[model samples]
Target: MGKHALLSASASKRWLSCPPSARLEEQFRDEAGGSPYAEEGTAAHALAEHKLKKALKRRSKRPVSDYHCDEMEECTDGYVAFAMEQVELAKQECKDPVVLIEQRLDYSAYVPEGFGTGDLLIVADHVLTVIDLKYGKGVAVDAERNPQMMLYGLGALELFDALYDIDIVRMAIYQPRLESVSTWEITVPELMEWVEMELKPKAVLAIKGEGEFHSGDWCRFCKAKNTCRARAEEYLKLAQMEFKAPPLLSDEEIVEVLKVADELAKWSADVYAYAQDEAVTKGKKWAGFKLVEGRSNRKYTDEEEVAQAAQKAGYTDIYKKTLIGITEMERLLGKKKFAEILGKLVYKPQGKVTLVPESDKRQEIAASTAEADFKEE
Candidate 1:
């Protein structure tokens, strides 16, 4: 909890969804060394900050990091270019538009000690914009009504709302790895309306650690997700659906089941992982479970030695080569170079049909698309 508030903006999605989870999360300690993904993101942010500051003719030193690579280099360059465009636009509104990089913003008026560092904050008379850089590719982050970005908006407004005659607040997320750039804009009055009604109430409940626990997609990153009773009951309710129905689940029941199918599998895996960790590390054995060796395959301790031994034994046809994965290739060549070299040669096949909730951003494939596939098969 070094810099993490009990109701931090980053975990607002989880805490707001299940307010009591803020207190529940306090029971679990942070992972000792943090995760590689988070560290990589930090490195990328540091580099991006240096690049943006330099672009603005500010004094800053370029930082060296192990995570520096062609992909990061190109992405940060793109982010700096985007920041420069915003700066140019701000200059149209005022002669001296202030640009702040890696600034701490406070929103304690709404959230208790609710503050988060914004990646970039640009100020002008007409508009105030806060931009964030997302370095991960696992999931696309949209700024539309995003709790993290909105909180940052509140924080930024708190800093300069009176100083600047700002009518609109713009929050943008730049996720280059996913080829996503999202911006959500709201008038000051409209933003305050949401703050007074929704965000404030949620923040109050979260700070008090008082509210009914509701489990949903928000539980994905909750610290207590593995053992939370509310989550267990949510998934268990789906199992109970089998007996509650007559002989088969009706259409509505089936639809409800489909909604939580992915979450159900995830919950099971989380429980299994927790149980294994407890048994192995804490020696807390389950009633009917015991630790045992898992399946393994033999591997060469040193691949070079293995290759030499194989060649010495007259094994000439030992290796097979395949084209590198698209992501790795892109990183190797940089985005611009990759496009110039192999853009036309690349093609994407239709993905296998899968069911998802209506809220998913992907457009629904035409019924004829699946029907045509069936006919071909």
Candidate 2:
């Protein structure tokens, strides 16, 4: 853990997974420009905070909807709506609503050691609530024992301790994508214990950057993917696999064969680029072995004319009704059904996109569209 440790939700996960890499990244985060997605998330959170404070000031609970709020389009809208409703309900139903605050600030331990930013912290007469809005639909957040929320709760209690007689501090993870809210009622001692025992130690280790690479699906999105030694070795070994068709080559021969294949692949790419450039500069059209000067793209024009001629011959749709590529397949099968077939009908471990049986897919289309291949006359 360094002085510039990121005390955010994502930081914890990264620190635990790859401490060295996380430390390297975090230490140089300023040099690494902020991600667009992060900027969007921050913008959405700001909007939500503003709306909540506005609702509190007016003593009215009005729903805040963001039509073009891209950062929060996924979960912010729904979570913000639910939280506003809860605040309004608290005012209307509860005995006395104390304070509805936007960005009620708090910190863990001390500034250099532990620090956190809360999305929203509300303090009532008898209860304290901290709400975190998560926009991602991929992972559902649970508030119970959530370190991020726990840290937020700790900060809130510390800040508002002297101001109000806070009895119970409740934390909530409001996920709009799931249309769900999970709450955790924690005592002051329990929260303190969690922070000191679990969060602080973890935070220390994270700051120090002492973790191992625990491989998982999320590795696909990790920045260290290309440079990771473990991944590179595994991929190299996998690539070296033989066809097993014949045992014609010895160990040395096999190595040589692979080297030749690798070299050929690189050479082929370079040659292709050179040939394409020369053909263009020399004013010669090249397709396969055929070459012509001052003329290019003959095939597409010729094909169009042939298609028109075929139409004249009373053969319509003559662009060759070849097996539609995957893109066209997706267009033909709308998003929902295509997803169903892709996930449910397809096999696992190898989550490959697969087409369902013709009859089944057609039946799905018929049911949804209320017609079977309804081509206009």
Expressed as tens digits, the lDDT of each residue in 1-377 for candidate 2 is 12423555435444445545555454332425565655555566666666666655654443454433432443555666778766765566456655545553546463234555677777776578888776545657677777667667777877777777777788888766566678888887777776676666656665666656543333444455434565445435535766454486577756655544543454445456546666676865666655446555645558778888888999996554566655455446644566778646544442223334342322333343433223321
TM-score of each: 0.94, 0.52
- Relative to the true structure, how large is the alpha-carbon lDDT of every model? 0.89, 0.58
- Candidate 1: minimum summed lDDT over ten consecutive residues — where? 238-247
Error of 1 at 160 (Å): 1.0
**Candidate 1 lDDT score relative to the true structure:** 0.89
Backbone clash count, each prediction separately: 0, 2
Candidate 1 stretches with Cα past 4 Å from truth are 243-247, 301-314, 374-377
Q: Candidate 1 residues 219-328, lDDT tens each?
A: 88898999999999999987665555554768788788788889999999999999999999999979989999989999889999989999999997889999999989
RMSD of 2: 13.1
